[model samples]
Target: MADFIPVNEPLLDGNEKKYLNECIDTGWISSEGPFVKKFEAEFAQTVGRKHAITVCNGSVALDAAVVALNIQAGDEVILPTFTIISCGAAIVRAGGIPIVVDCDPVTWNMDVNQIEAKITPKTKAIMVVHIYGLPVDMKPVLEIAKKHGLKIIEDAAEMHGQTYRGQPCGGFGDISTFSFYPNKHVTTGEGGMIVTDDDSLAEKCRSLRNLCFQPQRRFIHEELGWNFRFTNLQAAVGLAQLERLPEFVQRKRKMGAIYTELLSDIPQLELPLVKTDYADNIYWVYGMVLKDEVPFDAAEAMERLRKKSIGTRPFFWGMHEQPVFHKMGLLKDVSCPVSERLSRRGFYIPSGLALTEEQMQQVAMAVKELFN
Candidate 1:
């Protein structure tokens, strides 16, 4: 058997250890350290936001964004069904409804054409998720939001170095969220950030992140909030990772190009699309959708690859198809056919920052062997 290749791995060869050591030496490990402030500032500047608030994790970042925006019970948020459950759950938890739609079969991002049709009088926001490595076509989303007076919450968690139309993805929306999980372009062990230009919203996020404690008296509180504060230790790692983002993005694109070059001839597979108008697909994980000629779904394909000592991951199941959501009577009749189909047909191969050209070629060969 060949060496077992992992699905994703973090690249921590830069100043990760040095910054961590600094945090330990300075005894500034928690949320209230210099690195936290520095990280937030740098991240805010990186994404072109005026404010950046660090949180415990990506889900909490979404939660904080929605809460800070005051999305309430009677409000509705339009989003892509083919994204992580956290996007929908964040809206649901904030007393807002999540109205999901299908994806563009090519980009695998939100189908902008369907968004306008889903908007209702109760619709208060549009949550645009930059799925995988590709940013959503935000032009139409922005137009619809402007026409309908709806807020835009961009989820750029999977699109750290990706840009859309000469602008960074996170800068496009009213409030944007990012994740720094180990699999991301930049990892902080486990952390996230909420970025926005609105001064009031930034202050609201700060209060919400720290349990809504009064500034003068820490214990005194008016409304409820979570202890979603991110640690300085994590911020130190994030700062180091942020510095190397350009290098990371370049590597991912190169890896993507290599995968496309190696596997483009495979008739059974549909590789991630390359679109240069907005931004090139960074190929976050080099996802592939099987063509109809393929006999099996992504699950079976992944299983076969696993047997070949190659790891893979399936695409997100639409929120409408979620058993928990279905049981709760949510999206009962919603049928995002594209999303549903992609869920079954799509899976990603190894495209991590740490992946070498040899490893990529190995993955490509394994995939080709399976297809043949």
Candidate 2:
């Protein structure tokens, strides 16, 4: 038996140790440290945004974005049912209703065409979450937002170093967010950032992440906010990772290409769409959907792969199908067939930055043998 290949392993062989050592030597390990500011600034510049605010994690970044946009109760925020719970949770936590639409079957991203139909007078924002390896068609979403006067909250958490129509992924919306989870191209262990061109919105996010602290007075708060602060130690890791993003992206793309070549002959699988009119795939993860004729779902396939020491991860379950959403009396009676099918059928292979050619070949062989 081969070594158990985990679903994701981060590549951290850059300046991470050097920067972390500097932090320890200087005693600047908290959120007030200098590395946090440096990471925020560099990340904002890279994404072509005017302001970037660091938060403890990606979920709170969405939370801050929702509050910063002032999405109040009874206000509806349009989003895809195919995304992670964070997108809808942010709105629900802000007392706003989440109005979800289905994703495009091919792109596996929020269907831009369906977004307009879902819009209503109560709609306040459109949360566009770029799916596993591709972007939601932003041009149509942008037009829809402009037509309806709705805010656009771009979630580029899975799309670090990726672009849409030549523009950076995180630069497309009124406010954008990114995660620095270990699985991402840029890993900070655990961190997230919000970027925006609007100074007021930027300021709101900064205040929101730090318990809405007043500049003039300590321990004083004008509005209630969470302690979602990213520490300097995390920022040190993030800054180092950010510097190597271009290299990481290149490696990911190469890995994806190799996997596509290796698995393209398998008729029972639907491989990821490699390109679109707007942009080429950065291949954050090499995902596949089991065709209807496979006679088995992703769960079964993943189990079989696990027995062979090959790890896998299921695709995100749709928000409409979430039991918690039903418990909260949200998204009740909502049906998105595409998202439902994807949730059951899709799974991603190991395409992490640290994945090597030999491991990739082993994974491909295991998958092929299982199908045979």
Candidate 3:
């Protein structure tokens, strides 16, 4: 058997080490260090936002955004059922109801057509999560938000460097959040950011992440907040990673192209949609859905691939199907058929920045062999 191929391995050969050494030499390793501010500034400019706030991780970033937006008890936020639980959890934590919409089968993103129907008088915001590599159709979403007078919270965590009709993904909403998990395009090991053009919202987020410390009295706090600060070490690494984002995006595209070329002939697989009208696929992960005729679900397929020394990861389970949500009496009777099907059949293969051409070929061969 060949060497095991993990689902994701980050490429950190650039200035990561140099930046870490600088942090150690300067003895500025906390969130107050200069690098944290630098990372936030550069990231805001890169994403076309006026301000960016760093948090401990992407999940908390969503939490902070929800609170900063003033999502009160009984307020409702509409989001896709086919996304990480963090999306819905944020709203629920704020005592707001999470309204779920179905995803488009092709793009694997929230179906824009179904959004308006879910809106109610209680609806305060629409949370748009960009899935895998393709962005949600934002034009309709924007128009809908405008007509309804609702805020937009864009989850561009998987869409670093991606655009929608030439506009940057993070620039579209009232507030946007991103994750720097190792699998992301620009990673800081385990960090997240929230960017916005609103000055008041930016300050609220900064305060939220730091226990709401008053500037006049360091020990004084006007309200409750979390200690969700990003360390200087992580920011140093993120700054270096951001510098190489273009290169990483290019490499991911190339990897997607290769996989599509190799796997297009498979009759049992449903490959990711290559391009939508607004943007091309960035292949955050080379995901495939088994056709209805296939004998096994993703779990069996992943186990088989593991035996062949190839790594695989299952897709996000729909929020409606989650047991925790059911226990909480949320989304109990709601049904999203497309999200359910995708969750059972979809899984991503190794397609990370660290993947080499040889590994790509080997993965293709292994996948083909399994189907044969």
- Model 1, position 250, has a per-residue lDDT of 91
lDDT for model 3, please.
Answer: 0.95
State which candidate has the highest lDDT. 3
Best-to-worst ranking by lDDT: 3, 2, 1
Per residue, candidate 3 scores C-alpha lDDT tens digits across 1-372 of: 689999999999999999999999999999989999999999999999999999989999999999999999999999999999999999999999999999999999999999999999999999999999999999999999999999999999999999999988899989999999999999999999999999999999999999999999989878999999999999999999999999999999999999999999999999999999999999999999999998889999999989999999999999999999899999999989999999999999998999998999888888888778
Candidate 1 per-residue lDDT, tens place, 87-190, comes to 99999988888899899998888899999988889999999999998889888789899998989999999999889998987998789999999999999989
Model 3 TM-score (2 dp):
0.99
lDDT of 2 by residue, 1-372 (tens): 889999999999999999999999999999999999999999999999999999988988999999999999999999999989999899999999999999999999999989989988899999999998899889989998998899999999999999999899999879999998999999899899999999999999989888888989958778999899999999999999999989988898899899999999999999999999998888998999999989899999999999999989999999999898899999999999999999999999887888999999999999998688
Model 1: residues with Cα > 4 Å off, grouped in runs: none
Deviation of model 1 at 100, angstroms: 1.0
Task: Give lDDT per model, in order.
Answer: 0.91, 0.93, 0.95
Supply every candidate's count of residue pairs whose N, Cα or C atoms clash at under 3 angstroms: 0, 0, 0
**Model 1 error, position 138 (Å):** 1.1
RMSD of each: 0.9, 0.7, 0.7
